[model samples]
Target chain A: MRMAELSRTSGVPVPTIKYYLREGLLPAGQVAPPNQASYDQSHVRRLTLIRALTDVGGMSIATARVVLSVIDAPDRTVRQKLGATIGSLGDIQATGDSGGADRDEEHAQAAKTVDDLLERRGWRVDETSPARAAAAEVLARFDRLGHHRVIAALDGYADAAELTASNDLDVLAGIEDEDELVETALVGTVLGDALLAALRRLAQEHVSGSRYRTPPR
Target chain B: MRMAELSRTSGVPVPTIKYYLREGLLPAGQVAPPNQASYDQSHVRRLTLIRALTDVGGMSIATARVVLSVIDAPDRTVRQKLGATIGSLGDIQATGDSGGADRDEEHAQAAKTVDDLLERRGWRVDETSPARAAAAEVLARFDRLGHHRVIAALDGYADAAELTASNDLDVLAGIEDEDELVETALVGTVLGDALLAALRRLAQEHVSGSRYRTPPR
Candidate 1:
């Protein structure tokens, strides 16, 4: 298909698709004699994934580029690809230096809490995984706010996360194609967060209403 | 304490604190002699909450103001406040008109899926809750991508969300002070999303490793 057809089919603007090509987010199409380029189904799939990463996943182009590279790499195993993709999803500033003794102590405590949770659950995750630090940072912030009760619910959150993660992997394990598997993993990891957060809010409303609201006569 | 002290205590810089004040995110301090003002512990706590909403919650200053106003409005019941706060957290553009027949059909299917999930779970959430549409949008995107497997896991995700939400309300119920309860609710809603996302990633790693990695002899 030509650029116009590609744009129409993918529901992306032609200029935006061109921008993605220029930015190396999408691979260049084959060019013919008058400088006309043609795209195929692979290009369409790539465009869909790009839109998912940027529009739905809320990832910056730079981070999306990194994730795309991980997806494109041929030598890495599926587990390796999953780790790199998840690593790219986190904000680097989250676990950066705090430069204060109080913050350092709080962070140390938070890290210990994460470590304890891992040990209690007997889950095997890398110590240096960005997610470890990211989770700890949230714990530290909760502590700073003097909300120990929220911190106490960590195990419950972890239990729920374990259930959801198992369901996520079960879906991933069903995909046979490597490209589709990685692409689905990326989409599931990113958009799944939005899905779970939205569902949690809905559930909160349900729980709050049941607990507090008066029953209609 | 004064402005400088408030800044020092909250770890938010003076200029940023001033900006929050100018934006009405923080209330005015008590006026003193020579055009000086004095702040109290309340200012420090407000600043902390403001930082959590913006930095940790990834909320815009305008959204933060809306949430803070909901926090300040004294007549609203806790359930009403939670509803408004959760509604405000979603992006307004998500459920807007997609201007396409295909998208409209997909959205209709997604909405039906959400309604079915609510019925299956016996959850009493308002039909108007923004989370319903937000979750539907995610489902629509998944359907567009031809990933039926991800969409198939919706019930699993909802089950996990229910567990976490139950844990969340338990913590909130323990807080006796209405002011602190609402404030903690705001922080928990925002930061708890991050906490859960990070933990889910970690759980994914563990599950992936356990299922895929070859054990050493």
Candidate 2:
């Protein structure tokens, strides 16, 4: 397929496809005799994954690239790929991992909170995973807001996460094609985040209706 | 308190406070004859909320403005405020609520999936809500990927959402002060999204460790 057909089929604009090609996010298509280049089925699938990550997953292009690197790495085990991909997709970028005295103390405290949560759950995950860093940032900020009680939701959130993680991995286990497995793993992490966030808001509406219903006029 | 003290206390920069003031996300402090304005405790609190929303919540200044407007309006009911706040914070922006024929068709199909999920869950949310739109976008993209089967996780996702929403509203109900109530309502919606996403990733690591641990070389 030419770029035009690829764009039409994938619903991505030609210029955006060119941008992805230029950024090396999408592999360059086979060069034709002239200036024209031709894409293929792989291009369609990759473009779709990129669009899902950027558009639905709300990931930055750079994050998408990191996730792609995980997908493209041949020597890494599935576990390594999964960990690398999950760790890279974290949205908490501005966290000062190292700072002055007070900030360092807070990060340590939040890190303890994170470790404690993992320990209590008896979940064997790396102590230094980016999720811990991101969660620590959230916890520290909540403390700054004088709402340390926000941490109370952590246990319930963990329960929910356990259920979701189980379901997500179950689906991953069923995919037979290795390429499809990797693709789903990457797109699923990002798109899955979007799905969960959206569903959570919808559920909030359901709760809001009954719990915070407009007081009778 | 003055702007400097407000900045110091809230950890927001003075220039940001001024920008919020100029943008009307923050109200102007009391004008003094010495060409200086004096802010108060409320300014400190509001600045904190603004920074939290913009920084941690990943909210645009414009969206933060919309959320702040809901918080400041006195006439809105509690449910109205909650609904407005949740509705306004959705990160999905490029949804084809208006688009070409094929796009609209896909949206409609995805909308139906959202509807079926809501109906099955006995949720009373409006069909046209943005959360539904966002979820539909996710579903449609998965469909394009030939993985419409990914919707299998919808029920589990919805279950987790119900649990989280209940927990959120439970906490919201315990807050007695109206100002704090509104503030928590807004920040919780955004920050809660972040918290849940982080927790989900951590849970995934746990799941991965057990389910996809790297095989012994």
The lDDT values for all models are 0.83, 0.79
Instruction: Kindly provide the TM-score of model 2 when superposed on the true structure, using C-alpha atoms.
Output: 0.90
Highest-DockQ candidate: 1
lDDT of 2 at A16: 88
**Model 2 local distance difference test score:** 0.79
Off by over 4 Å in 2: A95-99, A210-217, B1-9, B13-15, B95-98, B211-217
List model 2 lDDT by residue over A1-217, tens digit each. 8999888877788888889888879999898888789899999888878888877776778878788978898999765776677778765866312245776898799889989999998887765677888888888777767775568777877887888788788778888887677777777777887888888888887886777574433
User: For candidate 1, what is the lDDT?
Assistant: 0.83
lDDT tens per residue, model 2, B83-169: 677788765866322346887888799989999999898787875678888888898888878775478767877888888888777
- Tens digits of per-residue lDDT, candidate 1, B1-217, equal 9898777777788888889999999999999998898999989878777877666666669989999999788899976786677788865344212246877888899999999999999898876788888889888888888889988888889989999899899989899987788778888889998899889999998887788875732
Candidate 2, B209: how far from true, in Å? 2.3
